[model samples]
Target: MSTQIVILAAGMGSRLGRSLPKSLTELSDGRTIMQQQFDNIHQAFGKDAKVTIVVGYKLEYIIDAFPEASFVYNEQYDQTNTSKSLMRALRASSSGGVLWMNGDVVFDPVALERAAKVVARDQSFVSVNTAKVSDEEVKYTTDAEGYIRELSKTVKGGLGEAVGINYVSSRDKAALVRQLARVDDQDYFERGIELAIEQNGLLVEPIDISDLYAVEVDFAEDLERANLLFS
Candidate 1:
């Protein structure tokens, strides 16, 4: 199946204390997070991979940066959350399968290639990092079989932090959209995945990527930490 990429980049990086959108923030290497993400995806899937970026906060910058990418705008981005932004992007995608990533994440390109290869087995998967997890991370707990049991920021006694990357197959895409439509506007997209896992029997396996460098840039400290790691 063909794999499309959907990036959620609508959030205002209020905690980062930056005027620029988090995805546009430059890494220590001087490439913006979005630029690095595009390069990494290209390296993993080649130039033909269809990429859609959902933009809201400073939409012009993202548009200018990725003129070739398809875009879905979230006009109410300030009032909504990632779930809403993701819904917009998913709705715009053609059916088959999609690899979704949070636009502000930086990671080893190998992780993307691994996720793309392994996701076909289960038709759904989420990358996880067990090496280090802070309380601020979006955590998950897996069942004995390695299927995600619960996923949320408040989930305690979790296995690891989710690396903000996921894959959903065409068979499950409609169901995922339905689940997303049922969630609160303020909910994270993972909330919809949690519901799909519980009610629709969607098997979202966890792909451990702890050995690889991956970080979600949310706050100023996260950017500092990412710079330290990538510098």
Candidate 2:
């Protein structure tokens, strides 16, 4: 099955405190976060797939950096969240499976390969990384078998990190895009997944990407952690 990467890069990123979009933030290696994301995708998918990114908040910066990426502008980016951001990309894609990701999470190429392989089997897989994040970090709960059960806004006890990478089959991908279009309330993309799970009984085939240092730059402190992890 053909696969595509849809990146959510339209958030305000207020925590980063930078004028540039979070995805454009420079890493110690000189490559920006968006660059790393595309590089990793290229390494795993090669020339077989395309990279689609949802741009908002300084959209030009991200667009200029990755000229090849299929840009879908989220006009309501400042008003809404990731769910709306993701919907923009989903509508842009015509057909085939899609690998949806959040711009903040940086991952290794192997982690993506693992996610892709799982999706190859079911074509609807989402990864859960066993990160030791604080209780405030977003939590991803999995079923006993490792399939994603729910994505909780608040963490309870300790939960795994999502790593912001998920794969959806062509049918479900279209359904989800349509689902978001129907929803009157503006929720983030994670909420859309939950809705898919509830309404369509869609299951998430989960792969663990815990061992790698996949960083989510939510705040300035996260930036420090990322530097430590990457450097």
Look at candidate 1 and tell me the lDDT of residue 127.
Answer: 90
**TM-scores for all candidates?**
0.96, 0.90
Cα RMSD (Å) between model 1 and the true structure?
1.3
Q: Per-residue alpha-carbon lDDT of model 1 for 134-210, expressed as tens digits?
A: 78888999887889989999998987899899988777888888889899999999999999999998888888999
lDDT on C-alpha atoms for all candidate structures: 0.88, 0.77
lDDT of 2 by residue, 57-82 (tens): 99988888888878899898888878
Q: Tell me how candidate 2 scores on lDDT.
A: 0.77
Residue 180: error of model 2 in Å?
2.6
Model 1 TM-score is: 0.96
